[model samples]
Target: MRIIFLGTSAGRPTKARNVTSIALKLPDPANGFWLIDCGEGTQHRLLSSKLKLNRLERILITHLHGDHIYGLPGLLTSRSYFDGAGPLQIYGPIGIRAYLEGVFEHSGVHLEYELDFIEIDSTGIIAQDDGFIVEAAPLEHRMPSYGYRITELPQPGHLDLTKLAELKVPPGPLYGRLKRGEDVKLAGGVIIRSSDVVGPSVPGRIVTILGDTKPCGNAVILAQGADLLVHEATFGAGMEEKAEAYGHSTVLQAAEIAAKAGVRQLLLTHFSSRFDDEAVEKLTADAQTIFPDTVAARDYLEIHVPRMGSNASSV
Candidate 1:
């Protein structure tokens, strides 16, 4: 999977950054995009990119802050302008229904497709299916907030065709059966074990995307053993007091959470407009003191979220 950051600024937009939005592009665009937080001008941000509106399948909002949610109405409506001829499933905190209902009513804009809502008022296993899961946890923002976690399902290891060929195992339905963990029995009564032909099962990848929050225990809990943590580092290390006062995290605090959570990679976003490019770099450098893989993100940045054990080849 890949993450495309549409916007990554905090509370406000700057010339270099827009507000908050992230896209988890699935193989099937019609299945829609898994969007996180539709900050103001989010649809416009997509206009500059290769993303299409009709592909937005699911939207997960972490909070009700304007910067995090203001783009929903416009995006949902603007979707009609594109080929969004189907329904959109939106997951967010409580009052999302009323909020969207009000916005559509106030603007006298009725949509052309379906609008389904899931109000996430608590933290738990918020979404799950055959392939993946999305969980939620409360965050210490001034208003009610949440952090989301995405876990992709494990995959079956690749079949070692060379092993089968070496064993004179003719490629046929028997190979398919063996790949599904069944021992293949040849008409000659030769039995081949699946273990000899397949490696271990592929492990799933864990990703935690945090909303605006302070250095709270919940952050660490949600981020445990994550492959990638998209967290908010709104301030520098020396500004911890300001960070706390504003209910946000400094670079050091974010790093400490990543370190404690044993995360493999840390990607920072939602930066305060106060810090410019150079300052954000300095802030990430400080975070690396606690976790070396820490990086501060910018708008339109592309990050490859590898499926677990793809390169390492370990389950």
Candidate 2:
């Protein structure tokens, strides 16, 4: 899996950054991509990236803040013209459905595809498929906000070829059945147990993406043991008081959460527009003091999240 940051600025846009949008691209291209947040100019940003509107499968909104959802209506409208005819699922807070319906009605816009809005009221497992499961939890934000934890399903282990060879098993449909953990009896009346020839199942990977929030317990719970933790660092170290007052987190607080969660890697984003590149670097350095694997996300940056036990790195 990979992550593409479309916008990284907080509250408003800057010369270098737009706002807060992220694209979580699954390993299978057929599954398309899931968008985390849709900040202003998000569709414009997508124009410059390799992602396509028609391939967008699902959208997961963090909050209703302008910086997080202003681009949603425009993007959805534009999708109609872009051959985005497949059914799309959207998950967000209670008002999300009303918000979109109101926009579409007032603007007299019609969509060519089906839109499924799944409004989230409580926290727990929000969505699940054969490949992955998504869980949501409340966060400490000025308004109602949430964080998402996505977990890939565990995969079957490889078949033990050497053991099969030792048993004089010929490669055929029986091998396929054995690989699927089925016991098969050979023509000679010898039964082979799949458990004796298959390795342990591979563990799935976890990724946590949080909305704008102050340091909170739910953040830690959502991010615990995640392969990648995306948290907002809207202020530098000395601005803790301002961050708290505004329902945001400073770089230090973000790093502390990453440390407590024991995540494999921390990605800091949603930077305040007041900080320039130099100031952002300084904040990242401060965060590294607490969590060495912290990365300051930038617009257009692509991060590759490998499988569990593999090192996650930026492209």
Candidate 3:
């Protein structure tokens, strides 16, 4: 899995960064990508990256804040020009559906694909498919905001090639069946059980993405044991008072949440445009004081989620 930061600024766009947007690319190219927080000018940002609008499958909006959703109508309309023709599901807070509908209706914009809008209220599982399960939790913000937890389902165990060879299994269709944990009959009339050769099942990965929020319990709950915790740090380390006043979090606060939740990696985004390079560096340093594996996100920055057994880092 890969994480691409399309826009990392908070509230508004800066010459250095845009607004809030994130792209989560699946392992399979055919699966396309999932978008989080389509802020203004998001489509223009996409054009600069390798991301294709037509390949966007699902869009998860955290809140109705303009910085988080103003680009939806434009993105939706422009998608058709990219040959986008499939079902696109968008999940968000209560007013999201009405907001999109209002925009589309007012502008007379038509989409080539089916648009599915799901409004989330309380905390619970929102989406579950064969590959992943998505959960949402209400967060502490001025408006109705939410945080999302995405977990990839457990994968099948690896087949022990040494054990299979020891069983005199030939390199043929039988290998596929054995790997699938199905008992296969050999030419010699011997039945081979997959359990005898397969390793333990690999645990899935968990990724948590939070919207604009102050320090809250829901942040820790949704981020528990996550491989990557994408939290908004709209203020610098020492700006806790200011952050709280604005219903936002400081870098230190976000780092504390990651540490408390036992998350492996902490990624800080949605930065205030007022932060210069020196201030941003101080925020990163302060966040690292609480959580060593923390990264300050910049626009267009790409981070690969470490495989189950690997170390997490930005590519």
Local distance difference test values of all predictions, in order: 0.86, 0.94, 0.91
Estimate, for each residue in 204-273, the C-alpha lDDT of model 3 and write its tens digit: 8899999999999999999999999999999886677898888999998999999999999999999898
**Model 2: per-residue lDDT, tens digit, 238-276?**
898999899999999999999999999999999999999
Model 3 earns a TM-score of 0.96
Task: After the best TM-score superposition of candidate 2, give how far the Cα of residue 290 lies from its true spot, in angstroms.
Answer: 0.7
Error of 1 at 65 (Å): 0.4
List ranges where model 1 is wrong by over 4 Å.
27-32, 167-196, 309-315
Tell me model 2's lDDT, rounded to 2 decimals: 0.94
What residue pairs are clashing in model 3? none
Ranking by lDDT: 2, 3, 1
Q: State how far residue 279 of model 1 sits from its true place (Å).
A: 1.0
Candidates in order, TM-scores: namely 0.91, 0.94, 0.96
Cα RMSD to the true fold for all candidates: 3.2, 1.8, 1.4
Please report, as a residue range, the 10-residue window in candidate 1 with the lowest summed lDDT. 306-315
Candidate no. 1 TM-score: 0.91
lDDT of 1 by residue, 32-131 (tens): 4689999999999999878788877789999898999999999999888876357888998898889999999989998988899999877799878777
Backbone clash count, each prediction separately: 5, 0, 0
- Report the number of the highest-lDDT candidate: 2
TM-score-better candidate, 2 vs 3: 3
